[model samples]
Target: MAKGAHGSRQAAWEFFGAELKRRREEAAFTQVELGARVFVSGGYIGQFEQAIRKPQLDVAQRIDETLRTDGFFERMWRKLIKDLPFEAYFAHVAELERLATKICQFEPMLVPGLLQTPEYTRALYEVSHPFATPEYVEEQIQARMDRARILKDATRPEYWVILHEAALRVPVGDPITMAAQLDRLREMVGEHKVLIQVIPFVAGAHTRMGKMMKLMEFEDAPPAVYTEGVHWGNLLDEPGVVKQVQGSYDLLRAAALPPEASLILIKTAAEDHRRCAKST
Candidate 1:
């Protein structure tokens, strides 16, 4: 079985590659010895590190049990299966989310994609995308909803969002639907599990409004950043690029309302909407 067989094209071979290298080190085996144990060529191991390909399940299981990694590879395999239909662009983002220890998201426009309520998400999508007809809308909804599971996974990672004020004020769909959406945001904030900060309209002349981004950190690799525009997305791996994005986000965080303050703002907005709904 080829490395791609395990993941096919779920988008983060580099992560799988890093995991393989880390396990090999923990097992105290050279690539040649580890490869021999798994019946893979030593060069195959090299390629896995290069992320040119990944190892198959049979090989993955052998290494996992031998190194006592305790189902890391097995669980990874399962997650990859669920994300099989991920688009190439989405696949890359999904992979980062999978391996991330912590994720910091900045939605200079709408709510961060991962934390969006279904109705709000659909509203945003419908406005931006002309291609999502009724049939496609449902498909897109399922795909978007699927991402919410990551927040509840056993390996649940920390989530932090910096939502721009415009994202909250602009009523998507309608006032009623937008009210429900704000209420959903309030509920999530109440859990105390996710932290949210609002970048007010007052904080003018900011950086990167046209592009939204997520900063992902993994156990093995250095942290990396991803930014997306209206159509295409770009991943930044270089240390300099990572630093720039991280710094910009840090500045954004400083300029925005603190988490606790943001929660109050969100809750107040929700209540105001509910009251208006009753009066109508």
Candidate 2:
């Protein structure tokens, strides 16, 4: 039987969960029996089957081995691992992003992760996780970098990003790192990999300030709106809510500078950062 056919249509993770359940049953293993082989509780297996939880990489691998599925679960786990480094609440959003046909995002404070350079990503992680071990920090940086691969995929999504002027101005690291970050944005804009609009400081406050919002449109699923805070995030999929948020994002995009002008502003900011680094 096809995955997810046993239940209402849902996200890819849910489909994966359904497939896991089907395979377990075909192998004549009860949830408890499977959990014993995977070293997790029967309840955890139930959560996986119901798509209420995601399996860790190790757990997925163990399940694959126990079920003799020839690495089927492990292969699916690799695609899902792109969600790593994100909070658990937002993992599904990451998966959605990977599968999206188009993505639009607004960032008020920092550069979007998809556009961040490795150096820039590292600096952000170091500051945010002040007490994290070097290994952990490196692991997170790698995961962030890995997420960028979606932008380079054969079927890359059409990306449109609206960045607040404050995000460009605030120095995440030293002048050099900031300059490189800005240059990176300029380079991507030049390459036409993404469409960028800058909400200039002169434009003043507008709709959807003080929070980061991303709207993702998928080819096979309904659109989603994601909003995030420092330690938490919400993925909104209700049709009414998604429509409202999409309208707000459209307004914000209209209020921002045009792409040509935004590119200039970004390049100018990069030059200014370079000059500041030279003077200091």
Candidate 3:
């Protein structure tokens, strides 16, 4: 039977635990026997089967070897890992991206951060990682591009993004690439699932926080807010606190143009970039 969304997440936990239990039982091994093979206590084996403890790589390998299932744990690891090159920082973002029913993003940097073009993102990363080799930059760009692909899937989440005017004025790459990136932004506005807003520099200082923020609403879970900088992100899910952050977002939206006007502003900026590219 097809499971509902909430059921599916819960089912993943159960399914993973049950798989461990089934493998042990199928091998004619009791909890104590399996623990002996894997160099763990019987209580740890029981906990593994009960979804109370996640397996480390070494333990996972030991468990797989004792069960004689070649690469079972490795296969599961691939499934558990998201397409993230940034590791710990991206983990929370990955979960939110997967579960978000609606996402409201406010980006102070160029474009909505998630919708950033490879050329633009590379330039930004390059500034931050000036010491990074070419290969490292490519890795980051590929990771970001892969992250963006989630929105292309049939189950794409609803996305509404607000971009500060400063984001529009900043040229991340060379003029040509900048213009192409702007054009891409313009084209993306046509996507029915995305709402893009450009808050002009002329809007002046309102809720002038220097970083970006995302408000994610979920199906069965309470909404959360995310803020990221450099190497870390904080996810706020506390009840009353999330409400206040959302209220702040509401006021921030008021400081920016409505959807229609925001579109016009974005298109005009794209056209200006195109003109600049041609002149240069």
Candidate 4:
């Protein structure tokens, strides 16, 4: 069965866990015994059963083989993940965004996802998936817009974003789209909805110039750092690594233009886009 929507991801996971436990017991295998077959630790098996962690696809397949469920676990894994709006690797990050009390992000060459306009998102998707059907592209665009709604919630996280000047100057969609997107950023800053800073081109050779990172803090759990590369993402929670990432973010923040100045830059960028649009 397919999960319904955003809130249903947890329910789907719980179902996955319950089914795993039932099948494991039916096979008369202890968690340790099952772990041996799946090449994971007994504690890891327990974590899966408790839904404390999600297993990789290969592990799910191994579990299916070990329990002789005829690919039941693998199918369930696909159902749970495939229905998500985000990419498989980014699904967990979307979940974390809802739980975070504060979020700090640095983008080197693009506007952060939460601030992207539909036209801008469409242009990006079209370029990335040249052969994708219009329906599929629209679906992805809607998903991105839905994700942006986190900022609208009354208990929204404290959002802080640092963008390199390249993000502002690069034309995403046409001049019209760029103008609209920058105007959106200007509105967010003007309303005090978010804290934004820009690292101008004048500030060269800075830390995190080629990396995009997000730091999220939760009310009860330890903070985490997320970094993404082409087609992959890594979520880091080790205390040492988190501390180091936090230090790097601090340095980047120090190198940025303040909120007031950044807002001005954003407005200027919007005007430039407007002029370009009029010319073309």
Scored by lDDT, the top model is 4
**Candidate whose TM-score is highest:** 4
Local lDDT at 208 for model 2 = 84
User: Which residue pairs show backbone clashes in model 4?
Assistant: none
Cα misplacement distance, residue 32 of candidate 3 (Å): 28
Q: Whose lDDT is higher: candidate 1's or candidate 4's?
A: 4
Note the Cα lDDT for every prediction shown: 0.74, 0.84, 0.74, 0.88
Query: What are the per-residue Cα lDDT tens digits for candidate 3 across 69-187?
Result: 89887567455544235565556465567667789988887676568888888888888889999998998887677667668878788998888877777788777777777677767
The superposed Cα distance between candidate 3 and the true structure at residue 68, in angstroms, equals 27
lDDT of 4 at 246: 97
lDDT of candidate 4 vs native? 0.88
C-alpha RMSD for every candidate: 9.1, 9.3, 8.6, 3.8
How many Å off is the CA of 190 in candidate 1? 2.4
**Best of the two (2, 3) by lDDT:** 2
Candidate 1 weakest ten by summed lDDT: 1-10
Model 1 lDDT on a 0 to 1 scale: 0.74
**Which residue segments of model 3 deviate by more than 4 Å?**
1-83
What does candidate 4's lDDT look like per residue over 1-280, in tens digits? 1224654777778778889999999999999999999987776688678765667788899999898999999998888878777889887787788778999999999999999989999999998899999999999998888888889889999999999999999999898898899998988877766899999999998997999999999875678889999999988777899999999999999999998899899889989989998887
Worst 10 residues of 2 by lDDT: 1-10
Give lDDT tens digits, candidate 1, residues 196-279: 899877888687765688998876556768887656677665678998999988988888898778877777767776677788
Please, what's the RMSD in Å of model 3? 8.6
